[model samples]
Target: MAWDTEATKQKLLNAAIDEFAERGFAGARIQEIAKKSGCNRERIYFYFDNKIGLFEAALVQQLVTALDDVPVRGTGPEAVADFAGRYFDFSTTRTALARLTVWEGLERGYPVGAEQRALRSTGKVAEIQNALPSATMREAEDLLLTIVTLCNAWVSTPNIHLVLTGAPDLQRRRASIVRTSELLAQDTV
Candidate 1:
C-alpha cells in the first residue's frame, strides 16, 4: 500500500498547531504531537526535519490561510473597514493562529518565518494601499498592523477583554475594531 504523504503531513501539522498553541514551543512535546496526529514520530522528522521546523511550517500555514481567506474588496476607506471586520471574524473562528502568534512572541522572541511572512505582509499592505490610494505606504502598513494586532489581541488575550468589558462581547469588540479601522482609513486617506 502506498502511504498518503500529504494527508499524513496535514494531520501532523494540525496536531502540531493545537499542541504549540496550547503549550507553546518549549512545552510542546514530539511524543504528544505524534500521539495527537496518530502518526509515528519518525514522520515528523522525515517531513519537517525537527520540532522547530514543524513549528515554523504550522505557523506559516496558518499565516497563509489568514491572508488568503480575508480579502479587501471595493476601493475606499469602507473597503478597508470591511476587510478589518472580515479578518476579525476569521480570527475569532480560527483562533489557533492568534494563540500560536502569542506563543511565538512569548517563547521564540522573534518571528519564525520572517522573510516569507514579510513578503506576505507587504502584499497585504499593498491591498490596503489599493483600497485607499491617498494613503502612504507607511500609513497602509501601519493600518494593516493595527487591524491585525487588534483582531489578534481580542482572541489571544481574552482575560484582558473580560477585565475591561466585564463580559466577552465579541460582537461589540468586532464592531469597535471595524469602526476603528474605518476611522484610521479615513484619516490616512
Candidate 2:
C-alpha cells in the first residue's frame, strides 16, 4: 500500500525526531530514520537532503510546536511563570527532543539561524531586564542563565518510564523548578 502524503511526511518527521533524539546531528543516520519510519533510505534523502538537514528540520519542527503550545510572546512576570510551566510540560512530554536540544547546546552552543527566533525571545529577557531597575548587563545575563539552568534541570530530569509510572518525582521536580523560577524572577525584579 502506498502512504498518503501527510502520513508519509509525519512518519518521516517522527522517525527523524527519534533518530536525532538518540544521536546528535553528527551521529544520526538516515538509514536508521528510514527503517524506523517504514520507508527506504532514499526516501529519506528524497524528503530531506541528509542527516544534517533532517536534524535541522526536526529541530525547527520541534521549536515550532513548542512555540505553538506555549507561546511566550507576553513580556511580564506571568510570562516567566508560563515559560517555566510550558517548558516543563514540553520537555517532559518530548523527552527525546529535550535530550537532543541539550546535546545540541553542549556540542554547538546554538544554531546559526537561531537569531531570528532568539531575537523575538529576547523580549522576555528584556521584560525581566526592564523590571530590574538597577540591574547591570551582567545581572541580566545572570538572570537569564539562572532561568535556563533551572528549566533545563527540571525538564531533563524525568525519563520515559518515569512518565509512564505517573511518578511523583516528576511533579516534585517540576514544582521545585517553578518555585526556583519564581524566586529567581522575583530577585531579578
Candidate 3:
C-alpha cells in the first residue's frame, strides 16, 4: 500500500497550526505537534525540514486560506466595509490565524514568508483601490492594513476588549468595526 503523503502533510500542518497558535514558535515542541497529528516526528522533519519551516508553512497556509475565503467583493466604500465585516467574522471563527499572527510578531519580530505574503497583500490592496477609485495606492494599502489590524486585534487581544468594554462582546465589537470601516472607506472616497 502506498502511504498518503499529502494526507500526512495536511494532518501535520493542522496540528502544527494548533500547536504554534497556542504556543509561539519558541514555545511549540516538535514532539507535541507530532503527537497531536498522530504522526512520527520524522514526518515533520521530512515534510518541513525543521520547526521554522513548519511554522512558516503553517502561517502561509492560514493566510492563503483567509485571502481566498473573504474576498473584497463589489466596488464601493460599502464594499470595503463589507469586506471588513466578513474578514472580522472569519477572524472570530478562525482564531488560530489571529493567534498565530500575534505569536509571530511577538517571537519572530518579522514575517516568515515576507515576499509571498507581500504579494498576497498587494492583491488585496489593488482590490481596495479598485473599490475606491479616488484613493491612491498608498491610501488603499493603509486602509487594508487598518481593516486587517482592527479585525485581528478583536480576536487576538481579548484582554484588551475586556479591559476597554468591561466585558467582551463580539457582536458589539463586530458592529463597531464594521461601522468604523465604513467611515474610513468613506474618507478614502
- Predicted model with the maximum TM-score: 1
Q: Which lDDT values do the candidates have, in the order given? A: 0.94, 0.66, 0.92
lDDT of 3: 0.92
Q: Per-prediction RMSD in angstroms? A: 0.8, 5.2, 0.9
Tens-digit lDDT string for candidate 2 (124-178):
4565566555555566566656665565555555565367656557666677766
Query: Candidate 1's residue-wise lDDT over 1-189, tens digit each?
Result: 999999999999999999998899999999999999999999999999999999999999999899888989989999999999999999999999999999999989999998888998899999999999999999999999999999999989899987888989988999999999999999987
User: Which ten residues in a row are the worst by lDDT in model 2?
Assistant: 70-79
TM-scores for the candidates: 0.98, 0.69, 0.97
Q: Give a tens-digit lDDT track for model 3, residues 43-92.
A: 99999999999999999999988887888999888899899999999999
Question: Which candidate number would show the highest lDDT if scored against the true structure?
Answer: 1
Which ranges of candidate 3 are over 4 A from the true structure? none
Order the numbered candidates by TM-score, best leading. 1, 3, 2
With a 3 Å backbone cut-off (N, CA, C), the pairs that clash in candidate 2 are: none
lDDT of 1 at 49: 98
TM-score of 3: 0.97
